[model samples]
Target: MSSADSTDAPIYAGLVEEQGDVLAEVRRVAEEVLRDADRAIDFGGVRSSAAYR
Candidate 1:
C-alpha cells in the first residue's frame, strides 16, 4: 500500500478513540444550555404569563 493509504487507518482509529471525548463535551454543553434555559423560565416567569406576546 502507499504511504497515504497506510496513514488512513491510524488517522481513522485516532478519530474513533477521540469520539467519546467529543460526545462528552457536546453533552456537557447541551446540558449547560438547558439548565440556563430552565433558570431563565423560572426566574423570568415567562411560562405563567404571556408577556412575550
Candidate 2:
C-alpha cells in the first residue's frame, strides 16, 4: 500500500517516562527525543508564542 493510503491509520504509542524516579519531565524529554530523531531538521530556535494574521 502507498504511504498516503495509511493516512487514516491510528497508532498505539505511549511513553513510560518516570523521573527522580524520573525527573517526571514531560515536554522536555519529548522535545529532546523529537530533536534527536530528526537530527537533519534545524528546529530554528525555541519559540514562546506565535501569532498568525
lDDT of 1: 0.80
As a TM-score, model 1 comes out at 0.44
Q: Among these predicted structures, which one has the highest TM-score?
A: 1
- Per-residue lDDT of model 1, residues 1-53, tens digit only: 99998989787779869775676788999999999998776755656577766
Best by lDDT: 1
Write the residue-wise lDDT of candidate 2 on 1-53 in tens digits: 78865653332111232213233467679889988889876545534233322
User: What range of 10 consecutive residues in model 1 has the weakest lDDT sum?
Assistant: 40-49
> What's model 2's lDDT at 4?
65
